[model samples]
Target: MPEHPWDQAGPRFRPPPGVTLYVPVVVAFLVQVPPTIGVGLWLRAEPRWLLLATALAAASALALLAARAFPGLTVAVVAAIVTADLFLPPEVGPPPIALAFAIVGAIVRGALIWALGSVGAAWLVVVVVGGVNGHPWHPLRIAAATLALALCFAIGAGIRRRVERAASHRAQLVERRRANDQAERARIARELHDVLAHSLSQIAVQSGVGLHLFDREPERAREALASIRRLSATGLDEVRGVLAILRGDDADSTTPTGISLTPQAQLAEIPALVAERTGHGLTVTLDDGLRGRMPRSGIQTAAYRIVQEALTNVVRHSEAAHAVVHLSCEDDVLVIAVDDDGVGSAGRPEGGGVRGMRERAALLGGTVDLTVGPLGGTRVLARLPWEEPA
Candidate 1:
């Protein structure tokens, strides 16, 4: 279920549990009771008035125990008790410390209206009733009380804002992590698809050639079997390298499976890739215009994958006899163009292979497109931004 903003904010400033929540209650009780009792005795007040003063102080302190759970009601009850204690003989009652805690608790817990209304009503009653009872009105005392109450509200509001900001930051962190995980998963999927698809397609073709030449030409059949074995071994090594990377191991090191966990194929391997296809009965040529100039590792990887997927599609769908892969750097952009002479891509639906190619190029701020080539077949053109080495 979707979470509300308040629900996310609440846990950070939620009331404490067990004995921690009651610490304030205990402290308030101690502060109120002893002071009230000592003052009443020192003043030699009547027994009945002294007892009333102590009881009022205790009731105000006890009310705070429920302030967290029932902030509005607790504040209102404590306010009434404190006001009643004020009518007692001078210095007979302790300070209204408990009421301050209740008011702050109420405001912090989002009971602002209740807190303000309760305090306003209590203040009005005190002023009207004290004046009627012939008690002198002191402007200084009223101003001090107003300032104290304002400070409590300010403290509560400040605490609430801090908690809310912390909660928001946590939420943003979680969202960023989720997005990164998804992107990593997608990258892994594309890697696996490129590795497995090309490897399996080559294996299938070699197996067919081996079976067909088994009786007519035994030597060619053995050669086909050897090619199948090499493709399978290379495919396994690449898969292990990918797995080692996902396991947080160094891809440049050897793994327990006796496979050197090398990084993915890059620009330097394009000639070997073309030679492999040429050996497999496809006329493939490589034009390396950049010579030894290589782009960064990330761009090289993306470009290599794009070329690999383009070749795989040609072998699987183009039915082309001759193909050419052209690599060049123009104006700080790496351009890869693969052209073939065979049946065109006239009505071929876009598949995962094509989508994977586009995704790889896009990840590196590049693009891949298919068009009719000068060779009268399909052309796969990819352009990727390149950063020249210093």
Candidate 2:
């Protein structure tokens, strides 16, 4: 159940909303210039560099700062200026042209709503001014202005869709990365389990055999004792590799067994595994031609476990005279099957070890089969995926 370390990494920030929000609103409002006059003709307004220059810069800066919270309000105010142009001669003040983009952008992809608000604000101010100014309004003229506002709204809606789509894509990427990390963590867990479980199981069997020889035949016992020592050393190396994979950074040369460690174990370890198990009074034959062909650590561990677990069951329950383990790569799968002529029910599973054996296979995107062999021996078979990246 150990999880990926990257799962702790959190979400990243999205682009700050409303790209053009600050520019037009603040400068136009502060200097009290129409969008055309305050921004466009600021140099012309300065002419003689009157104290009015100081006043203009200060006013524009404040308006820009305050516009952050009131983008809608600033847009409303500018709309009012446009309406005033209908009754009075167009002033030489700044023209409020670009507020269109700012207001629309703030809507965050709800361009239609932004459009409605912009239109409503503009229409109310202009229509009311026409009434107050004692001027008879022309529908055609108003229609022209309303049409322009509608176009702006449409533009805003398009921008919103783009923003939302990009945001959704980013979110999907985050989720995919999270999922991939979880899968990798599970794979590592299975590899560690297969190594520890298989090796420990082998060591236990070797120790048992050595003890039996010590009591029955001293010479045979000595041979079994040597196998036991090798199993212990190998187990320590695997445990260390597991620790290094788990710790990632701090893991070093020695493992829990007080022996030096290797970076990883390959199929080469299989023969040694089989040889050690055979020394424990069982007959184990490993095919060496298949060694270099099997490359992935995950697959190696899975194949090792199937054989290891199968043998352990035989030693504990079979009371059988002999056992045989076979491991090879077939159709891109690291295939393993262990058979024993033990006296107990060969196919029956009465302990968690069998379940653990199956779990190990499942984690590798593989499968396990346990049943009685035709020879009346219990057979354990596992197939695991092999990594083949160059």
Candidate 3:
């Protein structure tokens, strides 16, 4: 469960087992407290009345407490209470509160309890007040039953209204949090694309080019080596820019200073990425026939990540030269495949880093596929959904 800052305790607010559900029963019992003591003065003349009333009140309290174990037992006990009041000479009493408790229990439980409980209570009201014409009919008994029913109906409706409102507010908060989280991830993705992609590309380019210094014009190889030096410095600057953004200090000063690339170049931008390779004597060709750009931001992000990971694999595990990245889209599926002419590099076959990349792809509704290409190069392939702006 997502813990709310305000939930100092747990969500349930459950009362001690019996106390919450049988609160009406407890209150009904307490209602007799005063009368138990006061009636002693009146009942001095007839000790039997005092003894009966006190015992019945105690019995009713016990039955209410035991309601969870024996459902509907309290109804009869309440009726017994009314009977005791009616038969004995009436006096100062706490019996009215007991009547209220019966009404509350009836509404909470079911109709049978209500009918039996009210009838038992009404029998006494009629007998004591004296009916229409010295017979068994009485208006006050009917009025009391009607009033109890209305009170329960009102309380039930209020409880339902509060529950519905709370549910609605909880749903709203969940949706808002989801949206905020998505927006944050997108912002971080963009920063990674700009910094990591450009740096890794430069590193892969000049390092490969500089290695040819022994053969094809040693002077030109020196320039390649110098370019590698500059590229490393630029990569460092971009990484710093990315870190600054993460630390909540993004500004013009935080902008990466380097060979800044376009915002929407995916695997299709392999030509530019391989520009240094082509210049330093390596052949590069890219095929991206799929049109309809896959949202500039998403394209840039996936492109950078795929290329950087592929180049790193080549540098670590390969002996041969050259690389090609084929990117396209078939309807909603974005297809990105990076392959290098390196003979031995089987790619990062198994690692948490690869798992993280897979997770990132899945988050965007896609997956990553790695295999050794027929052209003696490692291939890193990925597919992501093409989602449009709302």
The candidate scoring highest on TM-score is: 1
Candidate 3 whole-model C-alpha lDDT, 0 to 1: 0.60
lDDT of 2: 0.60
Instruction: Give the TM-score of each candidate.
Output: 0.78, 0.55, 0.51
lDDT of 1 at 174: 77
Q: Which candidate is the best by lDDT?
A: 1
Residue 344 C-alpha lDDT in model 2: 49
lDDT of 3 at 32: 76
Q: Of 2 and 3, which scores higher on TM-score?
A: 2
Instruction: By TM-score, rank the candidates, best first.
Output: 1, 2, 3
Can you tell me which runs of candidate 3 are displaced by over 4 Å? Answer: 1-32, 35-48, 51-236, 243-253, 256-269, 275-297, 317-322, 328-334, 341-367, 376-378, 384-389
lDDT of each structure?
0.84, 0.60, 0.60
Q: Could you give candidate 3's per-residue lDDT for residues 32-74 as a string of tens digits?
A: 7557656665656367777777766766665566444443555
